[model samples]
Target chain A: MKDVSRLKSVLEKGGFAVTSECGPPKGADPQAVLRKTELLRGKVDSVNVTDNQTAIVRMSSLAACCLIKKAGLDPVLQMVVRDRNRIALQSDILGASAIGIRNVLCLSGDHQSFGNQPDAVGVFDLDSIQFVQAVRNMRDQGIIVGGEPLSHPPDMFTGAAANPFADPMDFRVVRLAKKINAGADFIQTQCIYNMERFDRWLGIARDRGLTEKAYILGGVTPLKSAGMARYMKTRVSGMDVPDQLIRRMEGVSKDKQREEGISICVETIERLKQTPGIRGVHIMAIEWEEAVGEIAERAGLLPRPVIDDQ
Target chain B: MITAQQKPIDEIRGMLVPYKRILVLGCASCVAECAAGGQKETAMLASTLRMKAKMNNEDVIIQEHTLDRQCVKDFVVTLDDIIGSYDAVLSLGCGAGVQAVAEMFSEIPVIPGLNTEFIGETRAQGLWVENCLGCGDCMLYYFGGVCPLARCSKQLFNGPCGGSVGGKCEINPDVDCAWQKIIDRLSRFGALDRLETIYPPKNWSRKQGGGPRKIIREDQQR
Candidate 1:
């Protein structure tokens, strides 16, 4: 229950934490990550390094986290069950903790069909919720998944992804509750574009007292163009992009759409600040890292709290 | 039941190139039910092979026979009287049936004319969808009689992943998301609370994870 990560400490200290994503380069280039870290260095409390986002092969999240940590930034190592089995997952957790990465995000990643390697075998040996429990068991009980005692257990803050817009709308909150019950210390949701639906899901979550169990971070992504909004609205599964938002983006002049998108993102973050049980905003400016600093500053989330890691 | 599809005529023809006299064998059970290797299909395949060989100026002769169930030794023994006259057996049965036929007549070359697909249910006319993986364990009761291991693309036991959209899986628009079906079925039964408990990682060793599996049912043994 102790705060083992700077992101955890910041939330525990009652500070509105700001986090952003850093997608590792496709090839094995560390400089690409260094460049993103340079843009994100002091603006956010912690950075979440994705594990083969969209199932496209990329630099391992652990290696990327090491690079980010070396660059004087806290890194949340995103671990997905889509690629590795339970043994590899547990092994990586030990490896990550031994190397000083303190935060881990459990995800049942995007289906392989959505990625570059559509034929790749998706190793869902453990779902995201079960993965959260595995990490918790490894950290708290000082044991591996099969019940053997580890020499030194990983003391890391575990997180899981929640998709508020996924189908079977009535069961979304139930799934979120399951994640928390499985020992997810924190949650980062899928990108939110429809505030009405997001607010409705959050209301049900609040009613069930799920908000008090774990730290919830509202996910916000700044659309780069009107076309991207349309693609996300029509093509992206589990994403609920409102048509009105797409119209708003399309209504603006071509040159001003990016600015309009940023304005909308900043407004979403500001609104999230007032929402009950929302401890922070996770800005996923995909390939648009520069926009995160501007979004954070515009939403008055600058000067992120620097908590000394224990 | 176990479902299968007939291998392409070209592939079956290629396998029969060395033989002049062959038996076009079919199973009257699961494969017959799926319309892959039934008596009617066996006769048609025999006629086509004979005509194709004649057209190509090859002296090949084919005889067709459909067994009650090729997987059973009792039915397989019915072919024993005429087995010695044929050079090989082109079995239109499933993988298990073909193997069983091969085992019964140790001397005859058995070429499979069909590829075993999966344990499936006949959804409609000419449509067979896979419904079971034969994971060696069944937990259908927990899932409202729907098997997530067999139907889910990821075989996820806990719940649906984010890829489930509007009841269709993201992998292919044609395939219904198994988890969506499970949720709806459970909801209709008012048993949605069953999903509240987190199921642990499956013991995959019961599956092919432990290598080629076998069940020695001692009670059925003489």
Candidate 2:
């Protein structure tokens, strides 16, 4: 099969790939997306545009990815089942492929209650695993959800999100296996503040041979301050922030907290590099896009690998 | 059984303001079991309304009545003769019962005093948890008898979303993650393999998504 994603090519070539995120603005401003993409340009492999992440309405991910592509960056269009039904999802995948966006990430979006639009009705027409299956079918078999053949099948790489820190911890790897079985080309995990749980989860995956089936990219989010660390621990559901990290952030002087955060992020990246099965790292600076360039450079992930556009 | 909660006292009182005479009607079936509408509740609500009217210096006649099943025409017909005596009826019944009463007496308005909740079971004393959505399709056998359509926050068929923590849903810590319950139950029975196959997107067309539904039994009908 011809490779459609540069990230996939990098990973297949056994290079340590680095990807980052760029959240579209709440309002209709192309410049907002351009500014974020520029900061991440050449600093990462591909940029993922979130689809109303945290349930807050923003510029559509499809539109934002287009902006990112135009800004000379490879874009990964993130699609969440929370907003669109199966028909719309398949349609958007076709559209994303047509618009030169080659990589896509399937996600079961954050619940609407956490977003500004709490009253909005969530449309979970397909779970993330089912979505991965749908994307793979559309790309590989030229089939849509209902098995209808497309005149031209979409050529793209598919990815799915997994959270090792979420509850029922024992079943987390089983869920990852299911995603891989459903045809996930790659897996972007939830942020890894709890290194012990992440390492244990990856070990189980390696034992089960899940690591061989899909490329696993460890997720990292740099905390800017002790307050940010505490908020992630207490307010963010499914996020595991050890008390030691929080105290480490607090251990720094107020003015130097950012530098401490970058150091911690770099340390985490260094640890992920040695982990047996990890293929890459996904840096999600969450609104602080400027921090991603620094984190990638300081962690020695700069000067991204180049591959032929297959 | 269908469950409900009584509407606020102030809202009920406001609706009764236009009427000089009102009958507080209750259903003795599902609503009665849930303690939202019943003979005892009807009397209590009638008394409260009468007291509120007296305190407001309003001349209002409040009467109370309970039927075997407000949703059945057999029980609804008994109110025919005296239906014209009241300006309106405050039906302390589930949504179906309220509509049935309204349909029976088209001349008089039937205002619902209870908000119909969901089809649920009495889990414990003073606790009713919703267990069925009546989606018109049942897949309980595959899930160890747990209905993911009703209990799962996201109605996920493949498995739990990333929001399951400590066996509770991330949306609310008090709510047990339905998939967690399913996995535990299936694991105990050695049926965890059933979840390996991905269930397709639900045919919600068979549900309210299909619009108002109806069932006609020709064998039992005259």
Candidate 3:
């Protein structure tokens, strides 16, 4: 609560924050993280370091966050309960804070079955909501999950994930409220392709007054090709890519698809900015981090607002 | 009831490599109901082991026996007379039943032939599906009798985790999403509002976290 990061400060200052993600390399290569952070530097408010995203084995999120920090960019440490028990999670939170990382994103994580190591054992000791509560307690109450008093509790700006496209759609906002109540200061949602549906979700969220509780950042992933659009539509679960979007990508020439994708992303960002409850956008360009600057510039998110405090 | 399934024949055979005489023990209660470990199953396993031993030209004596319930002391005592003749006892019961037999006869090695699955009910003539996790804390009342801990692959109390598509789980299309079922049941009972409130993380001390749990009723002791 005390050591608010730049992302939290921007949101507090009523600035429309633009956050991007940097995926850690599969091996223990610090340069990979530095490279991605360098690309994301000065273009966005913060960079989210994914925690072995999609359950694949990669550099630990904490290590990557530290590396990103060394690269002179604010790193949002994405922590998933899928890989660690409460002990490890609390310990890592303290370690991350000790290393000057201020932002943390709580998630249940993609199940290990979806990863390369499908046979690996998952430790879902705490769900996303529970994780947020635990982090809040550590930051505010100076206590560990087991009620042990910590001499120096982590001062982190806690965040959680939300998927508007997930099934039992009516309950998505309700779940978001739960995260907010559990002490999520901000929420980065699942990738958005269907703007109309996202608008409807935001309407419900606004009606429920959830936007007041937490900073809502709409998730945007620029499609790379028509094949990527089709794959996202048919293969990915919990993604709501409309038929028209896929058709639009398909209609484009093979060479122009990437440009079309960027336009779509820019348009999505512009529309999301107009949405009632959305305060910012989290652009997940995946491995294509180099294009983030152009996309943000095109979406008019560039000339990033400079917060006075470091 | 606790259900189980037999391990592969090759693995079971490998376990009996050093033993000359073996007893294929079966639990006639839960395992029998699920057609996993029963009197008939014990006989078949004993015959298979004997055939394999003969094919290998190994001198081994195979015996078959089925107890009413291996978890009960009275039923475990039935093996006392003939147990001395066997070098090893291959138990076809749940994990608890196997331990019970091990506790009763400390000298002989107790190898588990069947892998204990879960506390479940027979869904069909031959199919058994998990119904309970014995998490020590039950939330069935809130979930309309469907235990999410047992049904949800993630054991999520506030799920179906975004992977729930249509009505099935993302891990496997055949598995029904526990939350979806809970919602439907709650809606039917005019209690869909129950799901509106978020459930906090489960108190895991009541689960295996507190270590081996026990229940002692002083009133029923005497």
Candidate 4:
């Protein structure tokens, strides 16, 4: 209950505060990170940093989160306990807090079988919900993993992922509430495509009291081109794209599809911002975060106030 | 890729011909790769054992299990059902693997179905042959990396005697003289300086030692 007043205030601006994602470099280089932050520094409220993002090794999320903090931008550190045991998770949380990294997104992470090392083994020691609880245990009790008291305990805002479009989506809200009860400070959702269906899920989420328990961040991704739209429509599952968007995409030339894309993304943001009960929008420009601010401004969603004054 | 090692299938069937219950345990790593005993092998053995038992006028309860690794403790810790349900184990891996099973499960007698071969290397498709003697010390560096301890017929330090003809060993004309191959390879690499230095008589105690040898890596262990 230490004032989340600043974070809530940041979201109040821009009507639907737009946040963007940036993937760290494949190797240890931090240049890609600096460029992303520089491009959208003041345009967005905070930046979301991905962890190994899709089973490929890169710069660690904690290191990138530290860099983002040094760059004077708020960071949402993503952590996956798939490869690490409880011992590693506790230490990493402390490491992030030692620096100024505050927000953390708990995830079960991609299955190792899907990575380049297919023959390699997988270790799913703890799921996202359990990870959130361990972070709470570390913060509230100041207890070390071995039951000894640590000199300093970390204060991090923990969050978890939710996908309303997933099969048996009913369980998603149920799990989201479980995460909040487990001490999640906020919830950043999976990419949203069908606003109507998502709005209906909001009803389920509202019934469970997820709205008041944590800051809910609805997610959006800009389809840069028709191929990008095709990739989302075909490659990613549990995503429901309305036919109207696809039909509109069919009329545009492949060369000009990206322009049409920016237009479409602007419209999606415009509609979501107007939807009741939605707290904020998490923008996934899919590597084109440069377009995020422009899309937000074009959608007439700029000039947002931090947190809801109502 | 396939062979029987621990208490042969027929032998176990013969012993349990009068009994009404039978169980088969399988290992999935080494044995599975060799195609001798794994999940597939266990299912096959179970069905065959059941068929043979029924033909001889008896009903048998047969069960099959394939543990991830029988040698490792973590993989075998969740075996409460397996230990109590089975009458015997028909491990089809090497002698070390069968011994591991016996050491872990002492109440029930364990049987071997396959003859455990020496530490082997795959020579071709579905074929494996012994390559090393597990000698305590390696002498390959002096012989141009060709090990006479394994390939040479007489384990000769300096060889290809007068009896050898056309680079073939005297004892077996069909087998190429391993020492001749070594000399040819060394000469090709122009490192024959290593060959002129004669080797001392082989040390038997350090290698082929009577007791098991162990490597204790202090840093690695922790």
Candidate 5:
């Protein structure tokens, strides 16, 4: 609706937009990003280039997004405040737009302690809300943070992350509202394995009319094995994988676990489609990029609509 | 008050490797309250250092002293008469106290024996929780006396991040989500609406900027 990118047009045209992620390689290997982009090329409407996702060092998100754009896929550049101050962040945002990257997701990334370089200092100069608000100011007012006018502001579709399953669940909806009020045009939430809790969260979101304010994309990651399911349930913070789903994965033989994981993802996508207030699904096939095509096909998201005209 | 904890015995011994004579100095104020760097702690550390040195067949003299407040110049001035006796001053006070002692006795080496933690209160017996960042500004009144800056791992002012689980922080299960406490307290006081007002990006200049901060009162200054 904002004439930002094809993904925006698809969502505006009432199509169930499918998006996925591509974690850039740790080194400067363009082929790795190109290969992942090729796997997700036609299956999803856009791809999110993570900014050192989980605080681990990787190729810069802007560079990866540029590579994705070269491969003919729309890249949603993810920017985290954990590693950069305001000056670097604004410079990168403008640089991303200069390179034809349109969608940008603002996030307060995982703390450095969780990363390999635990001794690294975190520069959380701005929180996620402040980041969203700053980006919106740059886009609409043609100004940088501090009221400094920009010669040509970046025209980008601003997106943010939402976690429906984090603690103090009652306050989650309010936080989402705050994000929307701060000018988040779209929201891609944390991976969804607990549909009931997510549905409940969506109910509150719907009541607050946040669904109308921002396009909500439910996150789904296909579990590769029983071990993966257990890890998601126990180790991943803010994740809500149910015990029943883990048991279902454990009940299957090792050979069938992968297939079961796909089925779970398909079922999740189908349920999310039916759930109110959610406009689309974001598939984070985390190192399992090859399965994205199959998951999208099985989940009935194939033939992604082409809405080039904004 | 400024709270701190003693460095491990092994770590303290490592810093004292080069020195034969040392003064195990302690502070009598905040560190004493937290049971960290007090008169009793100084004596105990002096004894341990002496015993450990003897076991290693090393000759050393460990003197113990406690000041009213090691951060104060007047309290640190008491060391002037007895300065030349020790090779180093192993300050059992907080970082501020250690710096003050180092400044007062410029010629002698000052080694920190305790890690200055934060401005906090003793929650219980042998328990202390950080309650302030000394951000140079105070916003506790707005959040029902619960400080998000010190309590929240992310220092989020709007609300809880998605990483909170069961009222615990994403970083650790032991940490209570600061937003949860703020919301609960605000709800009890019927001041939950205060949270709806979005806080702008913090002015870090006032909190941390330029060189070291200083406050002078004309009335108190001669």
Candidate 6:
């Protein structure tokens, strides 16, 4: 778990571990991803390459992660258990791990109906908890997806998503415990705006004895504008925005909301740093990345620490 | 057979918007069986788009084609030569087939005209309903062939909730109660007493993610 400790200390020394998302275009335009890396090159810790995000279909996540790596950036290749079964999932684990992608995030993913193509047949074969186990199984058991012995084992830090605001918050902690029991080394959460409620979730996680077992990263996304804020608040499922944050957005002019959003994000990071037991924050700026450096600086997450090579 | 259903249109012109050149692709595998969007739906969309284009005093090209199977690569390869001619492709197959087309031609911009609903089988003529969420585990034997996991609406692991009234789901009167069906089937088979034992919650892991769920014969493995 020293890798986990080193990953944490790197972020703790400076600011949060900011991760941006890259949605590859449907057409054969690798530039959609390459351009982003050029902009975020050396600016962030790692970029998450999505897997057919809305399930409308696009370039493969494995391919995009490879491109991100080629562009001199660390990529957390994301895998969704929705379209793939356990067999395909374990195969994909070998596929990604063999490619030298060490960081992987497991997501249950939005249902097919929520994607661009509704009416899409879903392949649930495995959900979130099961996904973490598959990753862990590959490393420890040394068994391939086909139950064959692998010549070389994969070194993957298995991680899964946690939604603190899911209907019953306590159930999420139970799910987290299940993740730890299932062999999840790290946990990245859904976007958090309601800090007070999220802190309560941390207390619940502590009570469940998940503090020492897994690395927990709070999910934070910077709302670039008032429209984006409102869309996330109302449209995005399983998301809730505090009234004060809403009021703060309402007070700002349309043009300044972007800056106000950065400020709000800074405020969130500062508040998050004070909270005990939280390992780090996974900043999802959505499409906004240039503002990330400024927010980190404003939050006093400065003076990058020396790199700890894996 | 892949059961697919189509929503009938007063007319089909509403679907082809802003695109003058349209390609209508249908699947004979699933959608074709249900008569939802199969070949019939493809033709309907094609003619409807042509009529709509004519009324607007603009020229529109609708090239209609249906493959033997949409899910298979060999069948999809049928469009390999002619795909470059079309501006956009409208698929009447499930979402999987449409994505395959999109993957086949990254630039063609295929659009879906039919909504690929649940993985259902037609009980009789023109009736297809969802039977399972494919939770990766099957406890069908314990429930006398009735799945409380899928049909119960609440996905209850136990028997029917108090909500199952008159052998119908509380949410909808028309929908038959999953547990009730189970109880009836079990009683008929003298397996009804099995319901008394409390069933454990599902372990979704065995269901899929430990690895890709596979059904293969080493004998069949090439």
Among the numbered candidates, top DockQ falls to 1
- Candidate 1 docks at the CAPRI level of medium
DockQ of each: 0.71, 0.68, 0.60, 0.01, 0.64, 0.04
Superposed model 4: Cα runs more than 4 Å off: A1-16, A144-148, A303-310, B1-222
Model 4 interface CAPRI class: incorrect
Q: What would the per-residue lDDT of candidate 6 be over residues A167-242, giving only the tens digit for each residue?
A: 4343456566776777777777878899888989899888767866887777788777777778877666567777
TM-score of 3: 0.96
Each prediction's TM-score against the native? Answer: 0.94, 0.96, 0.96, 0.60, 0.96, 0.62
Q: Write the per-residue lDDT of candidate 1 for residues B93-175, one digit (tens) a residue.
A: 99989999999999999999999999999999999999888888888988988898888887788878777889988778898
What local lDDT does model 4 show for residue B53? 67
Candidate 2 per-residue lDDT over residues B56-134, each given as its tens digit: 8999899999999999999999998888889999999899998999998888999999999999999888899998989
**Could you say which candidate leads in lDDT?**
1
Q: Is the docking of candidate 2 incorrect, acceptable, medium or high quality?
A: medium
Point out the worst 10-residue segment of candidate 2 chain A by lDDT.
A1-10
lDDT tens digits, residue span B21-89, model 4: 555767787777666777888788878887876687666687777787766666656666567777777
What is the i-RMS of every prediction? 1.2, 1.2, 1.4, 32.1, 1.1, 9.9
Docking class of 6: incorrect
List of clashing residue pairs for candidate 6: A86-B208, A86-B211, A86-B212, A87-B211, A87-B212, A87-B213, A88-B212, A125-B208, B6-B36
lDDT of each: 0.91, 0.90, 0.89, 0.68, 0.90, 0.71
Deviation (Å) of A54 in candidate 2: 1.2
User: Lowest-lDDT window of 10 residues in candidate 1 chain B?
Assistant: B154-163
* Number of the candidate with higher TM-score, 1 or 2: 2
Q: What fraction of the reference interface contacts is present in each model, in order? A: 0.74, 0.64, 0.47, 0.00, 0.55, 0.00
After superposition, candidate 1 runs with Cα above 4 Å error: A1-4, B17-20
